[model samples]
Target: MARASDVFTEGDADLKVLEVKSWLKSRGVRDFEPVSLFADQLTKDTVAAIEKLADTCTANKSSSAIKKAIVKGIPRQAVLKPSHAVYRLQNQRFALGDRVTMVQDSGGVPLSVKGVVIGLNTKSIDVVWDVPFMSGVTIGDRCSEYRGSTVEFDSCLNLTNPQFVASTNPKAPATSIPNTPFKPRSGPYPAVRPAPGHIGASGFRPAPARFVVSSLDLINSVL
Candidate 1:
């Protein structure tokens, strides 16, 4: 029995074509060796088929699949609306610190976020959360008594507005009155008093006695 060497190995089983050819060429054995597995002669067709199969089997093996390049650009109508609520809430009727659950609807699902009534408005109770978008609605829940297990503060005015400080005891300081226009016109004014015992200076006139008048008449007669 002719045992199967690598040069004449098997039928339908592929061999390292280069190894066999190189070994044969090195040994100068150009003539074919006898087949052992199926007793078929090594022909050009079989060799060519083997080479073609080897070429097909050799391919790129990659760890990841090749991805196509995508071109990206911003759309013309893209806009960022206000996504989160921006007000803190408190209820005037509720005590200062009471826990209230936030609700998606007026009485809908009680949200996970809780709210301490930080503030309240006539319409809505404000809340804050690590979250921003509420059910993807641009206008959030504006109903009274937010339902949630978590809470947040939104408006700066709620905590800092004058309404929060309405109970302040300090009254507004009184406005100082501006100085008068004349500002107390004062200095030494003229004194208009007459002599202490004298009557009216314009009404005084001296009267002559009757004897003085007669003596004046006799002197004139003697003359």
Candidate 2:
């Protein structure tokens, strides 16, 4: 079984696949082993093609060359559909309808303005601020009629943002109950009452009983 540290992210999967295959080949047992032996394989052919494409781009370094590389690199299963892509910053992830707040002031929007995520892509998230004033809709534009703003992942923090300490809420003031009288109980039961009998080996009795009668009791008493 693999530990959490042994796991690889999407960016590292291709390279790890290549390394695993190379190691297997070095051991001289390639004919029986299929590519499916490793999970998350982009396939050896796909890795080779990507390497070729990268080399071509590095050599040419022109707009036309880059465009040609992208054209050749398109996935074989490509289809037109509404993208449900998720974006990440640090350990926090952004998706549609996730609540977020601005950490820095930009354009007309002020810091700590709460907003809902309406859109997201690889680089940034589009938030619709709850404020009445217009906010910037793009990266560097002044202001737009839109209620929210577009900000880079680093510019805003999400509800579960990992950058700050988890114990504190930035919006709320810290409070303490000064000089509290409450304390934890020592034990589950109340203090034990003294037993009705005498103490061990001690000849002491608590007291002798004494009685006094009132006049009314005397009048009703038998002679």
For each candidate in the order shown, give its overall lDDT on alpha carbons: 0.34, 0.49
Q: Which one wins on lDDT?
A: 2
> Over the full model, what C-alpha lDDT does candidate 1 score relative to the true structure?
0.34
- Model 1: ten consecutive residues of lowest lDDT: 181-190
Those runs of model 1 whose alpha carbons end farther than 4 Å from true positions after fitting are 1-92, 104-110, 130-132, 135-223
Q: For each candidate, what TM-score against the reference?
A: 0.16, 0.30
TM-score of 1: 0.16
Which tens-of-lDDT digit does each residue in 18-124 have in candidate 2?
A: 78789989988775425322111223343334335444645666666444333443332232121211122233456555667766544466767776665455456
On the 0 to 100 scale, the lDDT of residue 215 in model 1 is 81
lDDT per residue for candidate 1 within 131-163, as digits (tens), equals 233332211222122221222322222332222
Each candidate's number of clashing pairs is: 26, 0
Report RMSD (Å) for each prediction in the order shown. Answer: 51.7, 27.8
